[model samples]
Target chain A: MSAFKKIIPLFDRVLIQRVKAAERTASGIYIPEKAQETLNEGLVVAVGPGAFVDGKLQPVALKNGERVLLPPYGGSAVKVGSEEYLLFRDSEILAKLE
Target chain B: MSAFKKIIPLFDRVLIQRVKAAERTASGIYIPEKAQETLNEGLVVAVGPGAFVDGKLQPVALKNGERVLLPPYGGSAVKVGSEEYLLFRDSEILAKLE
Candidate 1:
C-alpha cells in the first residue's frame, strides 16, 4: 500500500485496484486458478480533482475506498510494486456499488 | 432538411450530418464512388442544452452550423428518410474546425 501512496491521478481520474477472484466457494470448496471468474469490481484508491466546467471546478463524484463497477475496457494500467492499478476518467466508471 | 427539424437531441448531444465524399476532384477529374475516401468531417445540425455539472446546466460548447471533426466510431446512428445522421455527446466530438 505504501507504494501506491505516491500516485495521485489528475483531473477527474480515479485510480482503482481490481478485486481479486475468489479462490474458494462459499461452501469452502477450492476453485482452480484457471476457473476463477474475472470480476469487474474495483476499489477506488485515489481520486483527482473535478474537471473544470464552464470556468468552474466540478468535484469528482467518487470518494476514496468506494467500490465501483468498471467498464471492460479503457484505462491506464499501472503496476505499483507487484500490485496493479487502473486509472480512468470519472465518466468511464459505469456505476458505484453499494 | 425539413425531415431533420423534428429531431431535438437531449443533454449535450450534437446532431451531425457527415460531409459527402467528393465525386469529382479539384483538377476536374471524376473519382469513382469506390475510390472516394470517407471523410470524418461533419456539419452540426443541432445541439442539446449542455449536461448538468455541479447542479448547474453547463451548455454545450458547440453551436449549430459549425464544422466539427468526428471520431472514427461510437455515435448513435439515425436515418431521417434517406439521409443518415449521427448523434454524439459533445465530449465525443474530436474538435471544432474553424
Candidate 2:
C-alpha cells in the first residue's frame, strides 16, 4: 500500500474501513446478506477535528487506529486503496469497541 | 392526517420530517439542489427508547416534539401520509436545534 492517501474526511468526519460480516450466525444458521445490517466494526484511519461548537473547534474524542462500531444509516461509501471506507461525522459513531 | 402512524423506529432509532431547502442563495444566485449538502432541519416525530448497553435499555435524550438538525448523511427515505420522514438512530442526529 502507498504511504499516503489524499482523501482526508473534512469536519468531524471519520474515515473507516468496514469490517466483514460473519458468514454464519452463532446458532450455525447461514444468514442472507440482505437480512443483516450493514453497520459494522472498523478501524479509524483518520478523524476530523470534532464538530464545530459555538464557533470553536473541539478536539476529536476518537483517535486514529481505534476500533469503532458505526450506526447503520450514516456515512457515504467510497473506495480507497482496494478497500471500502465510510466517511461520517463523529456523532454518527454508535459505539467504540473495546 | 391520521391520528396514529403505523411506523415507529425501534432501538434508538428516530423518525423525522425533512425540511425543505432554499433554491436561491441570499446573494440571489441560483444554486442547484445537488450543490448543497443534504443535512437539513427537522422535527422529531418519534424516537426510540435508546441503544443497548450491557443488555439494558437507556433512555433517549431527545423528546418526541423537539426540533433537530440531522447530519448530512444517515437516515433512510420513507414516505408517510402527506410528508416524508427519515428513519435513523439517535447517534445519527448531528445536533438539536434551538
- The candidate scoring highest on TM-score is 1
lDDT of all the models against the reference? 0.80, 0.70
lDDT (10s digit) by residue, model 1, range B1-98: 11123565655777899999899999989999999999999999878766676669889889999999999998766554478778788999999999
Off by over 4 Å in 1: A1-4, B1-98
Tens digits of per-residue lDDT, candidate 2, B1-98, equal 12233554545777788877777788988889898655489888877657545545676778888889888775766543467677777777888887
* Inter-residue clash pairs, candidate 1: none
Q: Worst lDDT window (10 residues) for model 1 chain B?
A: B1-10
Per-prediction backbone clash count: 0, 0
Q: Considering only N, C-alpha and C atoms within 3 Å, which residue pairs clash in candidate 2?
A: none
How good is model 1 by TM-score? Answer: 0.51
CAPRI-wise, candidate 1 is incorrect
Native contacts kept, each candidate? 0.00, 0.00
Alpha-carbon TM-score of each model against the true structure: 0.51, 0.42
